[model samples]
Target chain A: MQIKHAASAGTLESSDITITLKPADNGVTIALDSSVEKQFGRQIKAQIEAALKALDITAVAVEATDKGALDCTIKARTIAAAYRAADVQDYDWEEINSWIN
Target chain B: MAELRRIWLTIDHDEAAAWAALLTKSGLAVDHQVEVTFGMFEGETLLATASLYGQIIKCVAVDPAAQSENLLAPLLQAAFDQLDDNGSQHAFIYTKPSTQAFFQSLGFKPLAHSDEVVLLERGYPDLDDYLHTLQQAKRPGSAAAIVMNANPFTRGHHYLVSQAAQQYDTVYVFVLSAERALFSAADRLAMVKLGTQEFSNVVVLPTRDYMVSSATFPSYFLKDRADLAVAKQQARIDAELFVQKIAPTLGITARFVSEEPLSPVTAVYNTELAAAFVGHIQLHVLPRKAVAGAPISATTVRQALQNADQSTLEKLLLPSIYRYIKEHSSHAN
Candidate 1:
């Protein structure tokens, strides 16, 4: 699915990631910043990409400011931003929650 | 006054022990479970220290000579900036009663009180500002008030609002701002605005760290029966602030709440609300709206969505809330 417009989710608080996204025509482009970027940058990006892929979302610009959010938090925020961008109402709750499972 | 620069405390820092001793000497209990502990130092000497543990900022103390100087505010400002840098927009400071006014002068409003510590916040809108904004849109006379999360605005919530709009001259719907909620705060605000559009007299406001807010009642998130006693006391302090400050500021004469059969936490909160406002404001306890012989609540609406129970969700939520949640709920996997 194509991102329809600009949207955001999450916060700057500890253990949270604030995700901002805008529509794109080709593929997902991610720009990320985090204190532990040197060590976890690739890991965080992988987590985000996995979430967007699970949502079947493509063609988007993603900006994520991570404050040590765990893998599950990154996924949730990424998918949440996707929902806001697509302007869809129903979400895959179990899939989003299954991070723990 | 001596110049004080911030010093982040660490085990290697030379003054770490001094900071610990100061809190004890100052009659303030030391919370070892701090997220960040720092102090204001004058050159090599530590004059004051404050600790942050989640929303609670504590372990604050000043050297005897520095007490007469104006230093607490700057020390607090340092802590506040740290909290903000970490993405906390609103925060609580645990301080001694004698120094309460010092915090108040710096835009920190007191929310709850105990014999030992007082809780104050820096980001909640001032009561006067809230009133001023409401004045431009509505009149002040015999208003009914309610504070709700409406995580997903249920039909039961709508029923309560409809009754309040008809029974009173004005209705103030205060949505509990989320430090964390399933629905985004922006979406929740928009849903309520559109949901209650028919009632021109209905004024929606953010429950700005006022009563039963997450900041005022952090223990509430625990949802454990073991924490019940402490939660009750916290709610009492919060409700007192509501009846004593917030209700009077808005000229609200009656407060509305539904009896909770589903959550023990809310049932205790309602009981506290009733007790706090007995002589000040009338408390109306409305019965929970039920569907399939069960109460219609945000909790049930969330469960239905998680379970993919479309019929239960449709029955529990207003069309707007259902639509909002359908589009906005954060998935769990």
Candidate 2:
């Protein structure tokens, strides 16, 4: 899905990550800010990339501010932000389920 | 610990006094011009507060007595969310030097700072991106810059640009982009471009809220003289931003400014600007150009336009600028 507008999801609270997605002419670029950047930054970025791959999104800019979130939380926030940026209201549950399974 | 509830101070007036007291107690002056204020309340007390003024975030404070030390993160997040909803992709904040590290932890990078204040910004298309665009205009020789509002683009402005162009290899004219002046930014820019088109080394560009803008110097357009101290502080910060970020980007080694003898506020700003550029960049203070025994000024041209004195305008402005002003006199204000 092509990103249509700028949208954001999640919160700044502990154990949650805030993900902001905006349309970009360049390919996917992630600006990740986390306290654990020296250790877990790569893993956090990998999870976001996996989520975007599942959604078939190739060109978008992401700003993720991580507050010690789990992998599942990162995936959920990325998916929500991608959907909002794409302006797609209906969730493709079966396709999402296939990615999860 | 009682759960903190998010409240809007602009919509709810009852908590306004407490918010003011909190800001004052935190050693911050209360500015009433902020557009939106978000407060985190616990029962009857205010715990944390942050405000959004246009794209700028100001007057952020967290109660010292509050249980959680992490109130700043949430407060800033709410402000950013409001800024995003308002369709602003970038955010700027002016805060004390002591709090720089705290803000940097949350992805805010420092743009420029003095002993008293530090300017920080978050989001894309930041200062580096701005400097990259300026890099395209970079010439090989020693360069000088002139920043002007040029409200009506008078002959004095022409003299300043002409003088700088003759002295330096290249002259970059940064026109103030704020719309609070009598003439619109576009009109002012067009006038400057036309006035300086005679010089091959002169390039006119908008300041783009980076120099002499409401974000950098809030009191520049405000007529109130009571805030002279605030105006001086803002002048220092604005000069530092120029010296640290802008001048080096375009290899500007000298700056030209017209002597401001009539306005005390501008005199103070000139003092602060000179002090900030000490030992870093050369400052040239040129005498104001005169016409028919009187100094040429945009204010004088504006007064003449108001009274429909075409003779005074003919003497003070270029022929082309005078014609442009004559055509747009209806919307001059």
Q: Please give, for residues A1-101, the per-residue lDDT of candidate 2 as tens digits.
A: 98987777887777888888878777899989897889999999999999998898999888888889999899999999999888899999898988864
iRMS values in order, in angstroms? 11.7, 2.5
Error of 1 at B129 (Å): 2.9
In CAPRI terms, model 1 is classed as incorrect
Q: Model 1 compared with the native: what TM-score?
A: 0.61
- Per-residue CA lDDT of model 2 for B1-333, tens digit only, reads 334445556666778888889999888898886888877777788887888888788898887787356887777888878877887767888999998877877768788888999988877556766786789878889899999999989899999999999999999999998888889999999999988889999988889868987778877877554388888888898999999999999999999999998877787778988999999999999999999788888999889888888799899999999888767767554
lDDT of 2: 0.85
What lDDT score is found at residue B74 in candidate 1?
60
The DockQ score of candidate 1 comes to 0.02
